[model samples]
Target: MDTSIFTDKTIVPEDQDLIRELKETSVLWYAIRNHVHGLYPDAMDEWHYSGVKYGWSFRIKDKKRVIVYLLPREGFFKTAFVFGQKATDVVMESTIAPSIKELLKSAKVYAEGRGIRIDILDSSLVDDVKQLIEVKLKN
Candidate 1:
């Protein structure tokens, strides 16, 4: 089954749809989006439908470089990032949480970078995601 809340290819999710589907977690969603935009004025975001398996996702990018992919779920969202060797090493060494570090370590290294998807169930993981975005921008 498709994990994303917005699975219908014909229907693109609007702000109200996300707010309704995500409920309280929608606050976190807006927080992160605003945080990214605040930090990087030129950052651009777009929605993409990656077939049936993955469904719809919102991608935030800095010009040509992708910063993160926000996947909307029923009550929460997942942030995906691709970190290069330097950024991965930085995250591994930082004080971001053991579980997240492990996720990065175990993620398969592709031509772009090591991709990891972090589920944002609550506000606890929001800062971590923002820090990771900074790492992505710096390295």
Candidate 2:
């Protein structure tokens, strides 16, 4: 089965479509978006279709710098972030989560930064994402 609900390249997902697929987690999705906008009023969000393998993803950017990518799944969503050396160090020293820290430790380093994608399954995980966002913006 496809991981994302919106896989059709010809079509774009609307707010109602997201609500139907995300269900309870839709609250988290909106919360995160609102949080980012609250932090960076000028943040711009756009949806992109990354072929069939990746499907559709919502990307948030603060001016030219990307803040995060929200990947919608069946009942939940994921948040992808790329942190530079400084931001990676901050995350390593943060109280985010051991698994996440481990993910960071093992994440392949790209020219951009160390990429880590986390599943925002519940409210507790949302806090971790928020912390990561703060680290990303600050560093």
Candidate 3:
């Protein structure tokens, strides 16, 4: 169990042992972790919405605007993004994977926003997730 991999402590659970085990199980998880922490080192904010889910805030100032939520599962994880109305159009225009593009189109837009979930089952998907995040962040 180690705390060194943590970038935002607010969302991370107290069970360091569990986090360490999850990190060891999935390499894709590590890639996502590195990208999130490395992309916004100082300004990164996190909130654990529930026992097994945590969201990341890619905010402008301190408004607590969460862009993505990461949910860890068996040997993989899903990154969920709730894009605003404007961003949804941009996402439709972006050059993301065909599957993900469909996900974006069909995601329900509610009181919060349009939500889409991308499962990080392989390292190859990291770039797509990052691209989607960039679009969501801009929104």
Candidate 4:
């Protein structure tokens, strides 16, 4: 995660029009919402809840879905982190873990761009996640 993506102060939604398309393309979106409640108890009540950054926040829809941040924090927003849905506990363990990893990768880039590092006050569970992360850089 490069700390140079969050230099811009003007970040808009990735693609409002594409949102409908994404929802339509991703059929499991609804299921994710239905199952997310147990994952994030207070997410539905508030989406952009403050955590470490204070400058940025997270947005959760339904219970199973999370739209943490959009853009790479640089170059007018480069990427986004959107989680899909989970079925059973085993599936959740398999899927959600990767989603979180992706989200964190995006966040890391955002934070690095802002010249800040992520400090977890209580990160007792970060190690439990199991997900393969991928990042592509332009030449």
Q: Candidate 3 residues 43-82, lDDT tens each?
A: 4544443321233212222246665666655455577788
Which candidate, 1 or 3, has the higher lDDT? 1
lDDT (10s digit) by residue, model 1, range 23-106:
899999988898889889899989999888878999999978889889999888999999989999999989888889999999
What ranges in model 4 sit over 4 Å off?
A: 1-26, 45-58, 61-79, 82-108, 112-139
lDDT of 4: 0.30
Task: List the candidates ranked by lDDT, beginning with the highest.
Answer: 2, 1, 3, 4
Error of 3 at 72 (Å): 0.8
Query: For every model shown, what is its TM-score relative to the native structure?
Result: 0.95, 0.95, 0.70, 0.25
How many pairs in model 3 have backbone atoms within 3 A of each other, for residues 3 or more apart or on separate chains, i.e. clashes? Answer: 0
Give the better candidate number (2 or 4) by lDDT: 2
Q: So what's the TM-score on candidate 2?
A: 0.95
Off by over 4 Å in 2: none
Instruction: Report the C-alpha displacement of residue 9, candidate 2, in angstroms.
Output: 1.0
Candidate 1 off by > 4 Å: none
Model 1 poorest 10 in a row by lDDT: 1-10
